[model samples]
Target: MNPFSYHKPTTINEAINLANLTSRFIAGGTNLVDLMKENVVRPKRLIDISGLPLQAIEATANGGLRIGALVSNSELAWHPLIEQGYPLLSQAILAGASAQLRNMATTGGNLLQRTRCQYFYDTGTPCNKREPGSGCPARTGLNRMHAILGASAACVATHPSDMCVALAALEAVIHVQGPRDERQIAFADFHRLPGDAPERDNHLSDDELVVAIELPPPDFAAHCSYLKVRDRASYAFALVSVAAGLKIKGGIIEDARLALGGVAHKPWREATAEQVLKGHAPSEALFTQAARVLLQGARPLSHNGFKVPLAQRAIVRALSEAAFGNTYAGATP
Candidate 1:
């Protein structure tokens, strides 16, 4: 790792004053530290924000929950309010990493986590995301884990956060504070697509710091599920995951929210698919149709054609579980 100066800031103002283009804010150091070791990111200064007053999980004025940026994944997942009101978020966080990592990973850090694309990680390889204009080897190289949605010629990487997928489905809001002002960004708009400039991951400005995540009311708590399929049963990144939240009444879907992970540059919100399921009765056929609608625009790479079908099945199973309140017995690859 490269030599860098470190600063521990107790106040957000102190942290903001210390942040710059060459400075990075560290929370749990789960992702940033790994990238630094890989030489993918080398900051001149590390601003430790863990001591800042951003470690609370409290109720919002609108009967929702506001999770501080520093709240650990394990804490957020097991908190009574989260477990009772937003089980999908809890399940998604638990599906990610291991117990030890979750104990250290923070909510904001998870949202800002970089893609796990092999090309981006290997400094020896040419990757547009790692060094813009160098070219993306994964575009035509080994790309089983590459993206199928919202990808460009410059990059085919997929976002790797299972928690963000659930947040997308829940329609959460992201609060950010910058050197100039504070702003609230819709969760869907927080992460950006890998367009020409694949180097940039999200809409966060260079000087902005995540403050908190504000979740809307827990309407789908009773009928929400997060299903992650991976190479292994545990402690693995998702090959394809589905976060499904449905409000079913008298055998008909009243409202629905669906988001996909491991297939896109950001959390792939299936708004059209949700519309297709809103007024329909839950069935395998209906679920299949919704899945098809969700993956209609998918353009899979050579090795990752399997992700399309895998994501489709996972989506169906997740929706089935959410709508009927029964576990699906199918196996995942």
Candidate 2:
């Protein structure tokens, strides 16, 4: 580990001031510490923003929620207000990390967590995301976890957060404080594409402090859910996960939204699929048809053809369960 200085600031202004001086933003110390240990991220100073008054979950006048960045994953998952109003988010959070991690991981850190790319973690490899213009090793190397949608030859990493997938489906807003002032970013546009610059992750500037995450009220999030498929059942990232929210009226989908994880560079939303299901009766046939449309442009790698079918089936199964109340049958082949 490298020698580093730590600073705990009590105010947002001071936090941003300290944040601008270094690349470190410490909240729960769960993700950053791990990366720092691996030498993936080395900063001269670590700014501890946990001391600030950023841990509040208050209902907005708009009847939505303003979740403080410092709020632990456990606190958000078990909050009575969140459970009663946004069960999907609660369920997603519970399925993530572990009991101890959920206790220490905070809202800001979770969204900003780095990708699980093996090459990115290894300092010996040439990953453009780890070092600019170094080139992407996963581009031709063992790339089963590489992305399909919104991916460039430069980078193909999939974002790795189930809760953020749900947030993307729900159209949550990200709030941040920079050296200048505060700003709110829409969920869809928060994480940038690797068009050319794979190094820069989110829309966040280098000197910004993520103050909070605001979810625009989901009147029906109580009826939503997140489903993850991994090689293992526990403590593994998603092979293909679907975070879905739907409202059925008279056994037909009235309003539907779906975001997919482990399939694309970003939290891939099945908008074409949702279009197929909306105003239609809840049924397996309809789900499969929409799933087909969503997976139309999937370009799978040699060893990852399974993900194409796996991601497609995940959509079908999640839609059926969320809309028609059906369980997923495992891949037959």
Give TM-scores for every candidate, taking all chains together and pairing residue i with residue i.
0.98, 0.95
Question: Each candidate's lDDT (Cα)?
Answer: 0.91, 0.82
User: What does the lDDT come to for candidate 1?
Assistant: 0.91
Q: Write the per-residue lDDT of candidate 2 for residues 40-133, one digit (tens) a residue.
A: 9899999888888989999988889999999999999999988888877887787778889999999999989988889999999999898989
**Regions of candidate 1 where Cα sits further than 4 Å from its true position:** 327-332
Model 1 residue 65 CA deviation in Å: 0.5
Q: Write the per-residue lDDT of candidate 1 for residues 253-301, one digit (tens) a residue.
A: 9999999998999999867889999888889999999999999999998
* Window of ten residues with lowest summed lDDT in model 1: 323-332
Positional deviation of 33 in candidate 1, in angstroms?
Answer: 0.7
Deviation from native of the Cα of residue 7 in model 2, angstroms = 0.8
